[model samples]
Target chain A: MSFKVRQEIATCGGKLLKLSHFSELIGLSMDVNVYLPKQYYSKDYEKVIPTVYYLSGLTCSPDNASEKAFWQFQADKYGFGMVFPDTSPRGDSVPDDPEKSWDFGIAASFYVNATKKPYDKHYMMYDYIHKELPVLLDEHFSESSTKKLDFLDNVGITGHSMGGYGALTGFLKNYDANRYKSCSAFAPIVNPSSVPWGQKAFKGYLSDDENDWDKYDPCKLIKRITNTRNDMILIHQGTKDPFLKDNLKTDLLTEASKNTSWEGKIDIRYADGYDHSYFFVSTFVPDHARFHAKNLGLI
Target chain B: MSFKVRQEIATCGGKLLKLSHFSELIGLSMDVNVYLPKQYYSKDYEKVIPTVYYLSGLTCSPDNASEKAFWQFQADKYGFGMVFPDTSPRGDSVPDDPEKSWDFGIAASFYVNATKKPYDKHYMMYDYIHKELPVLLDEHFSESSTKKLDFLDNVGITGHSMGGYGALTGFLKNYDANRYKSCSAFAPIVNPSSVPWGQKAFKGYLSDDENDWDKYDPCKLIKRITNTRNDMILIHQGTKDPFLKDNLKTDLLTEASKNTSWEGKIDIRYADGYDHSYFFVSTFVPDHARFHAKNLGLI
Candidate 1:
């Protein structure tokens, strides 16, 4: 459960600690970046810092969101920490896509527990992220600092694109337990089981069966899970995003929520002229931060 | 004098226009990115917008600073435009370092007009940046928009690393004429003539002669140029920056300014434990933005 500190960088009234630790669930070493906001360093700060887990999109590392998301400024303002987990497990031993494609291999885990051969050995990200990482983080941070951090229960979850889908699925799957207090996404693939990128990943990592794919899909999870707390899911999708029409059909999420307990609880804001890059993500990060801050009871 | 817009990305309450145009002095196509603030699009706004030119460091295109500087947010906040100019001319015909070292060739023009053989053909960045590019930008932006932009006259200058040296040299040399209304730097190489990076660039671009090198060195320029307006140059240097010991000795500028009119006017703030990366630059960008905003009469 102990993490090795790689680089602790001073940035934006806080420190970004780049850490590497062995994952007992995935059976691989993983890198994660945790930003401890300015309040964390304050001696008088008595409250346990609640974290927002930010998952990155395909073909990304922890560094992408840590560098470009521009979340530190907002985190400092709201007194919240941020966790940026790697998109997938990576190493020479780790099996990659046979086609050498970016979407289904090393940096494209899709946050799924693989049921297929070769991939089943290392692609247990779904279990690692939700079940194990948070508990391990809660323990490590508590032992490391006098001021505690609530990574397990009092946390929020958000991501971009594929990670966005992961966030929605995770938040909905654990909705009954209230694992995450807040949920949001930036250009997420809401209904992953129907999309080409998701289909390919599912076939490669799981199986060809739609029944197996439906288990991890956000659209299916929305109908299965009952929202008892009258919670909201915040999302921002850019109109000019190239992947909007094909892979990320944001409207399908609203359609899936209709006649269900989650109907009208999805706040999806379509930003005009914005694309699916970090530029778009950073622009609306302030808004998302406010949403998460409110749910986490910071504001 | 005309610019071709390669890409216009909507980022934070503004549009980042990646433009390309032929430089008359350098005799090559140069890339520059201009960020137009949200105020520019306002229909009823009457005031002419002022620009702040941000020169990038070595081994970087116009896109590096445009993507990472986080200047768009500040530009939108202050209602001022930002111009990110390339460091050097590029192409197959352009002469690079014989050894292909990243510091003294291709992207390392030192923002100086080369006086040597093949480099002289294309490495005329000094004249292009401080003299030609601004006028061309003024002409192009004025013709394109209903609300004019003051790119040439009422503009500020700033940069990082090698470009930091560029900012200091340009601001001091043009102080008498007040070419740049404001100036600032992040981890700048102050005494370029004394440093190894500056020595190699000066020898390669200018000549072996110390007198030629002195003309472009900020240490020398401060003594030569009189600070008649009692203007101050704000500079931020990271204490943990790797180059601080050698290439970027921030105190040398202060040492050179003593007994001169520039004494006590070079406000260099040494920030603790910040590195020479965009992380450090972006952290201090808010401070620099406020400084430029006030100087440009935007605040």
Candidate 2:
């Protein structure tokens, strides 16, 4: 339940704290980064700061978004804090891809609770990220600081690629419970069950039964969930992304919401000439921040 | 004389064109990245876009600042163009550091023309960056597009660490000729002739004559150059930078300016808890951009 501060980095009008903590769910050490906006350090600030959770893509750590996403400036602008969670559980004993490919294993947990052998031991990332991490963060911040930083409620969720799928799935799965107030993604694999990257991860982590895959698929989850609040899910996809045709079928998610309660509520923007990199993600971050800020009532 | 478009990346509200060209000065193929602001692509923008040349530090290609600096947003906000020049001339024919050290050869040219053997053949970065590159860029852009992108007179210069030293040296040395309109630096080595990193670069690139080193040292140049335009050189130094004490002594430049015409004109801001990495550089980019925009009459 205790976190070790690895490094405190001074960024744009904020401090990025890199922390590592032992997770009981996964039984391993996990790394996360938190960016405290300038408002957090100001003596005159009195209001509680809301949070935005950003999950990273394949082969990425918390450091990737912390360094390149350019989110600190926006967090400071909107008076909100940011949380960057690692992509997957990592350790020497953790099971990795037998082929040692980048799209699966150590850095790619697909944000699912594994029921399969070998992966079941430490790859409980879905539970670790959405469930345990938030409670731990709330307890830690409450014990350490006089300022109130919300980690449970008044939170927004967003991610890139695989994490995008995770965010969509999480937001949809917990829609009735009101888990996240806002959700967005950058070049996300919407229908992962159909994509090669998603299929591989699902097969490796979930089970042989195809029905189990629908539990985490954003396309399928959108059909079952009811959007009572008229909430909008913002998404940005690059037209020049190499994985657009093969892995990220952005149109499928929109197609899935054709007649459901989620119809006309998902905003999928196609950006021209942008690639599936931080260059593209950081560019559209300001828009996403504003979207989340509006939904979180920070604007 | 011609540049090859390696990649044109869409970032922020503009495009980053990665270009490679054959330089007559260095006699080697050089790579440079030009970021055209959104104004260039807009129909209403009629004024020539001012340019800001950013020189990267040791062991860095043009890609480092292009990907990490987060300068594109500022460029779009202020309607200014950005130029990122490579640190050194690289090829198999070009000589490298005898010790294979990062601080001496290859990516550490120190932006000085070499007068020594071997290095003298291709290490002509001083002329290449300040003189030849600008003319070539002007000619290239003039032929390629209708949008007037200024790379010559209406320009500012900035860099980090060794390149920070380069920016200062180039601005000060060419002050009389009015080469650059504004100048700023991030954690630059002020007194390069005295510091270990600078000493190594100067020794490897220049001749044995100690007088040759004085020609490029910013501390020495500041004392000799007269500040007539009431112009201020903006500089940001991190207090927690690992190389602050050993390599980057920010006070030396201030001390050198004492009793000289340039006294009280050097704005060296010491940022607390920041390091020598791009994190520190990107954090203060907005301030520097505004400073240059004001100096270049863009504000």
Candidate 3:
């Protein structure tokens, strides 16, 4: 990862640092924000905390997750590291869909392997989160010191919307059994096959083959979890979420888990009067932090 | 305020409600996210809690603070209201400075009464916080209910950078002594007279007469306070802030409070290797919340 340390400022608590990293991995130079807990530099150098990688939904960058999620308090108190990466690659010349839509082109990069002609080159978010980012995060920040390559000292993953799907499947698929112990999501698109966002992005990013689409779907992937991580997966969904009925199939996941080993392991909470936005996610983020903290044994 | 209630989602043991409130005051349709505590609709409607209004710095809107500050957990546990307002009035015709500087145009409203010609119409943020917005908040949100307001229910104002200045002065000047109680800031522009941001904003928003600047200046306002409201004021500043020298005058406010009734009442915490941003604010927001909770007798 050939990246430039754009700006590093000492925040009121920890360090608010930004880095511009570019690679052939993703077409654009991603801006990443790392919030190293106060304990990062404290006398407890040997003390390593579990890291949480937050992927923003669409049209967001590292700055969005860093600014919007309000996770630092939990990170600092819970003693965890947070890594935020841009949702999709960006630049003027990059090829985009002929039609303009919020879901495709700029803001939306389905966390899948884009097999389509135009987007296939740079839409490699799966690798960015799974392989490349871990290396990049370890190299630049203090969390790099905790790079034991073991899931216990190293990591956990979570995100909202598309990013949450990434977090759900990314941690499920990527981490060595030793490195990833827990995963959670906030209002994630569960059955992407049924959701408009997922269907559109999937069709554009992948071939017509439904098998390829299954690989990226969390609902489909949850069915394939051979062994559970920890005991349960925590998911908070809003009952009033505009897209919940059409897009986020919390019920489908609930039913699927009920019939599988994942039964009693999927904790699906139906939050009332909420929507598909960060405000819903931000409200419950600390709970996610606490959830991870408890299960990860960080607390 | 003709606001379209878009979506209200409840989660994180609370409620996340989004609304599109059009401020004839700002001539812009603003997106605001309000977090209602779990007990908001409980049987105990009379239960009062302290509310903290977080003002975003330049180039930020209400959306930024709600997205980033990461305050909900504490707000949920401690039971306080958080009100986030957009930085400046925005609209197509709203005059922006010819120079698209981050500090001057969209993000930076200076929070003072803008005396400049174009900004004069919509830049009435001073009134928005003190008068119009409060009425709207009380009308829509439970915390703003009359019983809660009667207790002089603890009202603490806090913010980062320019918003910090707004929090400081807003509390000092227009604060309903009978209602709002505590005041704190994170890396505020204490004495705008000394900082470039202060000089530019003061000149644009106020009269050329330097004496008038004292009205909005926190250091100057400190000397104006004859009786301390709650016990003291809390300020957390980053020593390594990039704009520490140019934008913030911590020493001036520190010295000013030292000579007044606030002498021992001012709690100034200087954190090492931090800067003027939300990362810094989030690191210490819990302490500030605890400070208000204690002063409000919520512990």
Backbone clashes for every candidate come to: 0, 0, 18
Ranking by TM-score: 1, 2, 3
Candidate 2: misplaced stretches above 4 Å? none
iRMS of each prediction: 0.7, 1.0, 3.0
Q: Quote the TM-score that chain A achieves in each candidate.
A: 0.99, 0.99, 0.91
Q: Any runs in candidate 1 off by more than 4 Å, and if so which?
A: none
Kindly indicate the candidate among 2 and 3 with the higher DockQ. Answer: 2
The prediction achieving the highest TM-score against the true structure is 1
lDDT at residue A244 of model 1 (Cα atoms): 100
C-alpha lDDT of residue B40 in model 2: 92
Provide the TM-score, chain A, model 2.
0.99
lDDT of 2 by residue, A1-299 (tens): 39899998888888999999999999999999999999999899999999999999999999888888999999999999999999998878998999999999998999999999999999999999889999999999999999999999999999999989889988999998999999999999999889899999999999878889999999999988754787999999999999999999999999999999989999999999899999999999999999999999987
Top candidate, metric lDDT: 2
**Residue-level lDDT tens digits of model 2 in B197-228:** 98888888888788899999999998777547
- Model-by-model lDDT, in order? 0.92, 0.93, 0.74
